[model samples]
Target: MNELVLPNDTNALNNLMGGRLLHWMDIAASISAQKHCNRIAATASVDNVSFKQPIKLGDVVTIKAKVSRTFHSSLEVRLVVWTENISTGAKAKSNEAFYTFVSLDENGKVMRIPELIPETEEEMQLFDGALRRRQLRLILAGKMKPDDATELKALFFPEI
Candidate 1:
């Protein structure tokens, strides 16, 4: 998804507003998740979103989103945002985040989602790391015990 950083989308300092940027990211993430599952997907959670650069007004914001991994009913969409200055043609990475979406049926119940097959090296790395990320998310949300986060525990305790 690409968006122009118009005046309305910017703050008093002429930089893109964080809320507006988050709205755009959620849209991009939902589209990716819905397309992956072929169902109506809703945002379940948003992981750490760090803004690395300030996107100035008149810049073109480009958001790339893809399903990093899928669980039984939810999937993680990794999004990277970049901003390009229209005049100077300079581009910078603005932010990166992971969004979790849950597929839903017509009755609004959670439905199963399709699996993601990572073929490329980058995709494989993201796919492999998604499990640990998900486990941490679940643990933080109180849906899973910290000790039950096997992948994350293994990562923190390499000798285990």
Candidate 2:
């Protein structure tokens, strides 16, 4: 997805507001999730989004999203946001995040999504990290016991 940052999309400092950028990211991620699942998907959560650089007005914002992994009815969509200065022809990485989405049937019930086989090395890396990220998210949401997150145990207990 590509968006032209206009004056209305920026804050007083002429930088694109975080909320607006988030909204665009959600749309791009939703498209990716829906395309993979072949069903409507609702955003379940947004992982931490750190703004590496500010996107100024008149910049062309490009959001690249892909299905990094799928579990049950939920899928993790990896998103990368970059900004290009039209006048200077310079591009910079602005933000990166993982958005979770649950595919739903026409009746709005969660439906199983298809599996994703990552072919490239970069895709494989993203696919491998999704489990740890999901475990962390579940632990933070209080939906899973910390002890059950085997993938996240290494962070606190390195010897494991």
Candidate with the greatest TM-score versus the true structure: 1
Q: Write down the worst ten-residue block by lDDT for model 1.
A: 147-156
* Sequence-dependent TM-score of model 2: 0.97
- In the range 2-87, model 2's lDDT, one tens digit per residue, is 99999999999999999999999999999999999998999999999999988999999999999999999899999999999999
Tens digits of per-residue lDDT, candidate 1, 1-160, equal 9999999998899999999999999999999999999989999999999989899999999999999999999999999999999999998898999999999999999999988899999999999999999999999899999988889989879898
Alpha-carbon lDDT, every model? 0.95, 0.96
Task: Quote the positional error of residue 24 for candidate 2 in Å.
Answer: 0.3
RMSD score of candidate 2 (Å): 1.0
Model 1 TM-score, 2 decimals? 0.98
User: Quick one: RMSD of model 1?
Assistant: 0.7
Q: What is residue 156's positional error in candidate 1, in angstroms?
A: 2.0
